[model samples]
Target: MIDLLAPELKIVFCGTAKGTISARTGSFYANPSNRFYRTLHETGLTPERIDPAEFRRLLDYGIGLTDLNQVESGMDRVLNEKHFDLQGFREKMLHFRPRLIAFTSLTAARIFFADRTIRCGLQDRAIGDIPVVALPSTSGANAHWTRDRDHWYQLRALICRAENPSWGEEQKATE
Candidate 1:
């Protein structure tokens, strides 16, 4: 099982589940075609190309990864209700107390919370004080948003600001 490297993470990115490549390689968004890693690298969250085994590096950047479906392997292998545990997720969130929680896909956010009304981008409510942001899925299967530059930009901005609190506050003041 790909347990969270740093449970008390500052920021957490939750996906639907482990894909074939990620499950096999024991890393989040390990597939080469996945835009998650590239987005992080392009946004300057990571210094260079990161190995799948170095997933903990994300935690060093105040980031962590988890999945709604905690299945060992294969995204399709997850069950309907059993795989998506809302109560468990709530417990994890309460314990982790991250400042920001981002969902990689609208479907994942909706399915995990059983709230179809929540749309893409930042949500109104917070899990305690933590803000939640839902972005378009970066999976190759999500053809409609296969290369969503806007989503990437938003994510990059969030990460950049989080990594630099002063920059975020300055930008907010300017805005």
Candidate 2:
């Protein structure tokens, strides 16, 4: 079992689980087809292409990664009941104390929270003091959202907020 170390997670991004590529590579969103790295780079979250082995660098940027289901290699491998783990996940959230928790997909947010009302944007709820945001999946399987420019855009907004907490509110006021 690959144990995930609870690094001082700043912004915890919760996904369903590791994909086949990620599991094999021991990295989150390691699939070349997945636009995760590209989106982060394009959004200026990182100065260059972040190698899968170097994902720990996200800690410096106040970012972290975890999954709702610790099992399952991919969405297809996930059983319906395995999609969420509220009790255990809450424990993790309490331990990490991230300033923000961004769900990589709407399905993940809904499953983890048992609330289907969440849309693909910032949520009003907080896990502890951590703000929550739901973003579109960057998986290649999510064709509707694959390579989605909007995903990168929204992520940029969130990253901006992380870098500057008051930026989001100020930008919204001007818009």
Candidate 3:
């Protein structure tokens, strides 16, 4: 699948690989049960819930999408390690220079970090000064992990703060 990326995006969500439905439809998070779009809306990252079919519209909202294993299309267990080009992904991040890079699933983050202990949240490590975050998978296939909105909300706040340094302060004042 073609990566939906551009320079200076607010954030880029990277997945391990395309799920069967996503690959078949040529859209990111194409599976009906996937919460990716809904979470973006609920976290106030987008004005409304975006349809999976119109995934490219994410660019308008300052969001980009990519996959670690671009050559494969399946679940994490089925993806081949050789197809995961971490260096290429890093190079892309260097070129695009998004404010944040969020791995859509902890598995994807683990693959990128090569550290299975990496948690699902902000990491101490970064790629060329760009912050990295790991979010719980929105895939229906991730039955082992419970779905959580807190991380997604945190990501939104981070994006707001990145865009405007006083955004978090203003929010706190309002509260």
Candidate 4:
């Protein structure tokens, strides 16, 4: 139930709720099958792989984590509307004001977006001044749909573009 947040972060990864394994292990994205941590490294968002148990160390990498449904732990289908606190999520986003709020799953982003018209990459709208993005879930259960890591790379590209547009351009040239 603890939110790993701070001020002036480059990105904050938000999910619908903790999965059974994550809750039991007291670690965000603790399930070995979950690709969250691996994606972070693969996307160049982190210099090295990070253990779920050491999630707090993400702050050092300018990243944070949270959930839309803080009161429950399961897949989105099993969750009820009452479990989600969109207002609290808004408050948190406003308070922390991270450059980006990257929802770890499309389901979580839909609730925040208040509509089903969501995409798997950077959103057209921003939550206040902070940009929003809906990412494919890293959950193994959703692997059928979340298998593409291109979306993850797109996110990193966005961050890179924001931090240094020329840097992103150069990286793209090499690709």
How does model 1 score by TM-score?
0.81
| Top-scoring candidate (lDDT) | 3
TM-score of every prediction relative to native = 0.81, 0.80, 0.91, 0.89
Q: On residues 31-138, what C-alpha lDDT tens digit does candidate 4 reach at each position?
A: 898888898998899999999999999999999999998889977888898979999999999998887889988889998888898878888898886778888888
Residue-wise C-alpha lDDT for candidate 1, range 104-165, written one tens digit per residue: 88877888667988777778776776678887877776776744546656766665554565
**Candidate 4 regions with alpha-carbon error over 4 angstroms:** 145-147, 163-175
State how far residue 116 of model 2 sits from its true place (Å).
2.3
- Looking at model 3, residue 123 earns an lDDT score of 89
Clashes of 4: 0
> With candidate 2 superimposed using the best TM-score fit, by how many Å does residue 118's alpha carbon deviate from the native?
1.9
Candidate 2: misplaced stretches above 4 Å? Answer: 1-8, 80-83, 146-151, 159-175
Every candidate's lDDT: 0.73, 0.74, 0.90, 0.86
Worst 10 residues of 4 by lDDT: 160-169
Clashes of 1: 0
